[model samples]
Target: MTSTVLTFAVSALTFVLVSLTPGDAARAVLGRDATPEQYRQLRAQLGLDEPLAVQYWHWLVRAVHGDLGTALSTGQPVLRTLEQRLGPSLSLITGALVVSALLGVGLGVLSAVRGGAVGRALDLLSMLGLALPSFWLGLVLVAAFAVALPIFPASGYVPLTDSPWEWLRSLALPVLTLGIGGSATIAKQTRDAMLDEMGRDYIVLLRARGLPERSIVLRHALKNAAVPVVTVLGLLFVGLLSGSVLAETVYVVPGLGSTAVTATQAHDIPLIQGVALCFTVIVITVNLLVELLYGRLDPRSRG
Candidate 1:
């Protein structure tokens, strides 16, 4: 209940901030010859002339009933636009997160177990990944896969319902960009958490009791280490909420990030507010779920 209200408050705040940016669709559509009188008229016509409090109240009421209002740029409903573009963006992020979780946790396990040359290499790689920007990484992946190898499309989106192969082809580079960056962040967190778990006296006692190494690490270490891993994941997801803007732009995927860029460029208040609110809600909801998962994943976390 707290989180639900929290989400609403944060999302409401996002609406106000995006709506406050200077200019509007009228300014973008009309030249400077667009007089102050003309601007006021246009704002009134769009109902954008209202005070922020009034605008926010009406928007909040409408959004609760699923009417997200219309984009100022195209005068199209925001929900309709989101529906068309959400699938590819969601698919890309979901696939990347899954793959990253597996590889990252696996590498982290190895790093915790070996503590040798392999561990050093994994740690080093994680650091590099942490430093690397996703947009730059996307460009590099495109150059390699599309430019040189010609294996994947350099940019574009394909609907999953249209063709599975097309979807995969279009999603590969964006996935790699996200996965590489995400996994690196997760790997470091996992490595550190696992290392801490292994140092616990119970783990030492388990080793003394002749528990199989695999059972000890997988069953014991991982279960205990998961809380922190989940924390990092929540943080990473928050990062992804905003970071995806560049990734989406680079890949030409019609996600909210691209929508945001267009909305901002065109000074489309409705679209901008809608996207910001949706993204904030998503990130907050993800974090809330992670919090619940921690209560389940780590028994001691309840304390």
Candidate 2:
């Protein structure tokens, strides 16, 4: 309970600091040529010129009533905008999580069990994935598969309602971009954890008892190995949140990353605040899920 409260307080503080960023959307969109009266008027209109505490209170009240207000730049309802775009981002995250968990854990187990050339190759592949930046990789993919070969569209988004297949195609490049690094990281964590677990006396005893090698290594061993893997998954939530910026822009996907960067450039306070809070909530929620996962995986953690 104490930890959860602390997390909420920390998140609130982070949101406050983010909201206090200098200059409003008007100032950013319009140059310094805008007069002082204009600035004051805009501030009053935004209610941003007020004390930080006051603005926070107003936001809290409005949020409780389920009104997030319109974005200053576009005049779009902030909540509606988030709802419109969340599907793409959510889909990408889901795919990355599922694929990374499977490939990483499977490859990691294979590498750990076989200390030969195949294992060496997997290690090198993992390093390559980690070293490669996601955005850069996205561009390379676009060039090869989209532009040069014309296999996919160069850049654009199609609404799922309009064409689900097209929307899926649009997401392919970004998924590979985020997934490459995420999956590689997962594989490495899994391999290291599994190897460490395998060396334990209990695992050795299971192997000695003439248990099926595959069953003992996978069913029994992977459960124990998940402790570190779950930790990585919690940390991966941050990567999924921030790393989407590049991929979103590269693919022109309507994810939070694109909107957040646009808000920053436009100096839209509410939009930026929305982005920050969204990511903060995601991270905290993922961490809580991981805590629950810990209890599920290791009964001792329930204590």
Candidate 3:
């Protein structure tokens, strides 16, 4: 019920905001120097001449039936446009999540287990990761790896079907750009959780029972600490979705983020609304999945 309300609210708000932005959809499509008659005809055909409430009502009806309308610029169905762009975005997001989880969990566990200089170093690195902007970091990576070293392509995506290896190579920099900050957050959370779990009486009981230190830390303490870390990961997924905009733009990834920029530039309301709606759905779905996962990890959360 809550999810349904949020979905409707976000969709309605997106529609209102996009409608309020100053631009004539017909004029944007027809361009300057179009005859007044041509503009009027196009406006009527596109239903732009109708009252705002009427326009929204019409759109809402069609959207309920899964018709997102046509993009003013491309004349293509918005759902089709989104389908074409969703793949690259998902690839970028999935790759970044993997990178963050492995790096963050590894660094965090190591820091907690071997405190002192290592822990301090991890702290400094996390701070740097959080401080640096993804786009700026992307540029630095491009210069070093793509320009200076010529190890990876600077900006562009390769379809996985064409060559799986090349596709992964292309996404490398963008993934790193989005993942670095996420890793920092996860690392901090994991470290704190691990520290707290290790200090608990249960951990002392396990040690007294002659459990191996490594087993106690990895199997017992880490499991108990996972609830919080998992929560951070769920939030990170949403952040990564938004952060992909900058990463995609910097790397020319041809994802929904880039398409959204193009749509906004051309005042493509249907396309813009479609993108916004798609993102909202994805975020809400991810959050729900996270909640389920959280309940699984910590059964107490189910209550």
lDDT (0 to 1) per candidate? 0.84, 0.79, 0.90
Query: What overall lDDT, based on C-alpha atoms, would model 3 receive against the true structure?
Result: 0.90
Per-residue alpha-carbon lDDT of candidate 3 for residues 266-299, written as tens digits (9 for 90 to 100): 8788898899889988998888888898888888
Number of the top-ranking candidate, with TM-score as the measure: 3
Over 1-303, each residue of candidate 1 has an lDDT whose tens digit, in order, gives: 876787688767777666667766788866678889888888788877778789888878898898989987887999888877677667877778876788789889899989999999988888888799877888899899999999999999988889999999998888889888889888988998999999999998999999999999999999889888888877877777666788888889998888889998888777877787777667767877997898899666678
The count of residue-pair clashes in candidate 3 stands at: 0
| Model 1 worst lDDT window (10 residues) | 15-24
Model 1 / residue 118 / CA error / Å = 1.6
- Candidate 1 achieves a global lDDT of 0.84
Regions of model 1 farther than 4 Å from truth:
30-41
RMSD of each: 2.3, 2.6, 1.2
lDDT digits (tens) for residues 1-303 of candidate 2: 755575446546855766666656667655799998888788788887888788767776676577767788888988888887677777777667766777777788888988699999998888888898777788898899997898787677777788999977877777777887888899899999989988999988998898998898888888899999989977886778777787788778888889988887777766766666666667777887999999999999999
Structure candidate 2, residue pairs in collision: none
In model 3, the runs with Cα more than 4 Å from the true position are none
Best first by TM-score, ranked:
3, 1, 2
TM-score of 2: 0.88
**Candidate that scores best on lDDT:** 3
